[model samples]
Target: MATKTWKIEKDLCRCCHGEGAFNNLAEPRTFLDKVEVYSDMLRECLDIDIPPVPGELCAITYTICNACIARLRDACNFKKQVQDCEQRFMTLYYKNAIQGLKPATKVKEEIEVSIEHAQSDTDADIVLKKEDEDDDDDNHFLGGDDDDGMSDDDLPIKPPKQSVSTMKTRPKPKPKPKAPPVVKKLKPPPKPKKAEPKPAKEKKGEEKEEFTLTVGADGKERFTCKACGKSFNLKPLFTQHYRHVHLKLRPKLRSCHLCNEKVLPWLRPFHMEECHGLPAPSCGACGRKFAFPGQVARHQKFFHMGESAHSCEPCDLKFKSRSEYNHHLIKHGDVKAYKCELCDKMYKWKRGLRMHMLVHNNIRRHVCHVCQEAFFQQSSLKYHQMKKHPETV
Candidate 1:
């Protein structure tokens, strides 16, 4: 009997069992030497512990997708927040309990200190009043002999001073007389000046450029502009040149009635739905709405009308639209017409080249609604949703 070999699938998420771009948990370089380990976080948040397997059994990829990683982070943050809140609550509870059990002796001491301060303030005020009365009495006895034509030795002996409960009140000074107010006559307002007449503006007539059409020997008509002396073979080209170059007018644009914004004819549909909150154009046959008019027309012709205008002989495939048929033909011929400007990468279809160019830029337009993970391509976002969040799809 021949030995059989089995192929083990590795591109799967350990948490959600989905496949897409995944981050390796076993590799340290993939985590950028972060302190928090993926396995530890999973165990902490979801209580899902991964066993430590030896390097010999490393054939399986211990990886997690972007969506799963986002979920894990949210779970970890929630757990940390709950733990912190519990710790804070317990600390506050203990503090309040300790404060409630404080001794009543400290409260009694605080009341006694406040009463002493009030008593001290009253006593100090009474002492200051007595000192002021004594100083006034001594000054009154000494002031009388200064103008009495008597020396200090010839002065009569001072009598004993009687103690007064309060000091003598000082006399109030008289108020000065007020001056009379002066009045003056007011001047009349100045007269208004006469207005001057403005000069009349010159009116210039509009210059009309006449275009003459001439038939060539080969029966091809040519248009010649008289203003700039430019010639064009087509009538539309001549009209466009005359309007832009001679009249200085741009091409006519349609203005949105709701927003009053001018937009090109081709981009009007997109602007209406995106800006004005209008519904996309729907098909009358199936009542199915499409983002663009081209999609609605294709849907009506392919499904409703059962149109298959283009067919492939080699593959026996039929496509309703010519563009789709051309795209199908490129696979058979292996002809790559679209080339990347930044890097010389080639693609068979223009859309393939457009999606490939996103690798050169950092733009992630498609985003997951569940975990809010962004992707460069819409297909990648769809795949992530199908794997990680099947319920949302």
Candidate 2:
């Protein structure tokens, strides 16, 4: 007996039946919901209604495609433009009709006669008023009495005016001259004090030896460090310990030719190319280029020399490249360096972390051309197309 496999069905657009991109109609506060609420707008503009599915109720998956939404927006905008033009035209027509009105025949003659008489009276009154003002001004200047017989002594007395030559103007005072600045001789700086010499202390013993070699009971040569009093079985280990701990010596660093920045000998080429825009080094054997000198050397060793330099001792597995060896070592170690900030999920590789981040964002960038189905990744899209539309492949 064969086991039955179950599959989930995808939601299709009600109008187009294509599932590339869509907006859920059942969701509230969404674009499709607003279109449903104002269904008459579509009818008045485009003369169309919402497409309905027989024997099925609109659910969360029931949606309208982007194409239909765009058409609806264009129709609504056109309808609004036509309405605005009609309103503007009617307003201008009424204003012109009021402004173009004609006066009554009986009022026209009376209005013209009244305007002419008013203009002639205003001109005569202006001339007489100017003559009267001139006569009053002349009488005032000649010291003539008023018609009321008021004497000049009883009127307000005015201050006497002075002639230009008769007026006394005070002269401005002159500014006092400034004195020259005084200069004093500065005293010479005092001499610096001489420091007293400190007495030298006596040495305890002749300088301590760095290391000493001895023969152990097991017949193995032992290397001992006199400074730290530590022993090592191997000479290489003893030398490395003395150099690192006692001497405090680090690896020799090289400066970049372009930037003058000091870096480790192994990292100098990479630093120069990445930061200073220099070309990467190429493999002399195969003429293949790489971002760093180390990669070129590794490539030469692995491909040209056919050597497997990296190996796992526990699993006894060997890999031709450093990257493959590192990847194989991940199974043995429980180290997770990459982590997702959204859900606090950890992954062994950066690619795994990036792929997991898509779940939090929920963005579908890859779409199947045959079925118009959308997916978050290209691999998923390929799988969907292969299963649903094999003929298209």
Candidate 3:
């Protein structure tokens, strides 16, 4: 057997900073410690994308591909690289938020009034010219009849005063088009002097509030890490990050019931029932419950167990049960598997990555698909819905 040598940088792991990791040493004698250790290592170290929240501890994997990892540690500044990526992320996020703004486009009431006035003035000029021509013709026909009827100076001079209704109903004239004045070409502004590009250097770790990532023998990586003194395997993570997200692997559970042994959810169901006081699962489709663990086995044999009725048409995926089918389909679309090797920021799906992108890009476009809430990830969308509007589900 090739003995694997393990070294956790003493600077990396510490019991303090109030962080702990669970270990699934090759064979854990106690199930309680076994479950915690396995979950912690996977969540915290091997896949440090998502770290534990206030009351939680992240999962860490006890596997690392030695050759690939050694290659990684050798090639680049792991800490600086992940941190720089995060800062760039926040900057980009701010820019997106700036872009999502709507501009105002409106025609002013003053412009409307000016157009109406111009039309009316043109119409008045045409009417006045016609009236003056009629008067001139009358003067020509009644020439030199001053003494026979009345002196020309004394002749009745009646002014045609328009009535209130006539003035109000008068048709306005078409306004003349004025030539648009030539537009002055704007002068180009002076170009800004280009600043010299600064040489890349690792940031002083103390300057910002930092999230730490601790790497282990297993290929998986995690945060909230202390140097693991215990010698462990250096197996690289074969677990696909997208498919096996951390919390999903943990039982959909409340506080654990067993004291002596932590509930090993990953353990074969039959083994759980035999070894621990696990309640036999009743079929949701048919309310028929079972007594030992052998019931599902018998049902599979008798019922349409071999034939899969539950299936997704899009992916041509089928499952024995509906729940299995649903869970499988969730994996088909763009899923979030983003883990910040920087701050231990973990998103449930790609949108989570996008939202993280927004935090860097400063994009906040993730409005609520449901109510007053908006989120960066689908998991967040689901969480808000569950918490605020449970009935909506």
Candidate 4:
């Protein structure tokens, strides 16, 4: 059985800037010492990418303590709640205050004018009623002459004249002035002229030809460039060839700045985020950052704890994880299964054969940033760049 070993350098915690609170390895002297030990064991995940290479040690994984993890969680939760509240408030204000006052809903000026006119009409009616009551009281006081010689049957009768104050006439509506009719000038009819002949568009060489492709008996897709007329089986190779050689443009596939991985220019950020250890999940048991949570869980269960649920029948090797056990099962009859299609070459592992096939296809996927040199294998390019260009490294 092959045993994998890892060495973690003794460094101060990134959060507390001190070694774990536990002073003795045998036992904890105080409650704070135990808490410190727990803090050292528990770690929060970061958003970084870990290297795919096995046995590669990363130093940045175990910097944060568990105490800081709790604080960070509480802070993030509070921030999210505040943001949600603010968003709800803004939505309500827009619906009730801003959107309600839009011209499409109600006219502010017309409402104000109508309210003012209604107040004036009400005030005028009240003033006229008070004047009419005052005039009636005055007439009754002057006509009460019963003590002199006037009898009830000999009183002089007079016709009542229409008083302006007594009669309540409605205000006449002012007539709206007629607007002047718009005089639209008639445009003269366009003069008929002889039609000029349209020039024929010249066909471009690139657009004129169609891509010619053929399928082999092996059921592999093959493509031929229309511009250069070069035949290729692999789509990636053909695309790279068409872009650089035929189109006279640089290939869109960019090499990773840190590693020899090649990816599209647009996908560079995503590839770097997942491949490099920027902010990746770290294992609580061992300070190893992984690309995913499942990876860290597997590492904690298998490496640090050594708790295996399954064991191989033939080899008697125990595995805590399902993927590791399945991989071990494949090694029981690990014959040379992978074979090269172009040449009489066979490899025990599929990855080895896949790397070997790149040579036959003549696909140089890895490119060095310093010298702009390309290589068929990533390992070769990595070693070449490191050795040849030590200054860049």
Top candidate by TM-score = 2
Which digits, one per residue and each the tens of the lDDT, describe model 4 over residues 214-269?
Answer: 54433344688777677787766776676567666774675664688998744554
Tell me the TM-score of each prediction against the true structure: 0.22, 0.24, 0.19, 0.24
lDDT string for model 1 (216-287, tens) is 433345788888788899878887787777677766786665566998755665685799554456778878
Clash pairs, model 4 backbone: 46-279, 46-280, 47-279, 47-280, 48-278, 48-279, 48-280, 49-276, 49-277
- Report the C-alpha lDDT of model 3 over 132-234, residue by residue, as the tens digit: 7987998788767555787677768787787553353455576777556555565565565455655777542221222233443331334331222222222
lDDT over C-alpha atoms for residue 376 of model 2 = 69
Stretches of model 3 off by over 4 angstroms after superposition: 1-180, 183-226, 233-253, 256-278, 282-304, 308-393
Which should have the higher lDDT, number 1 or number 3? 1
lDDT of candidate model 2 versus the reference: 0.62
**Clash count per candidate:** 0, 0, 49, 9
Q: In candidate 1, how many Å is residue 245 off? A: 16
Using lDDT, rank the candidates from best to worst: 1, 2, 4, 3
All models: lDDT? 0.66, 0.62, 0.45, 0.57
Cα deviation of 218, candidate 4, in Å: 29
The alpha-carbon deviation from the true structure for residue 261 of candidate 4, after best TM-score superposition, in angstroms, is 40
Query: Number of clashes in model 2?
Result: 0
Off by over 4 Å in 1: 1-311, 317-327
As for TM-score, the candidate ahead, 1 or 2, is 2
- lDDT minimum window of 10 residues, candidate 2: 108-117
The stretch of ten residues in a row with the least summed lDDT in candidate 3 is: 10-19
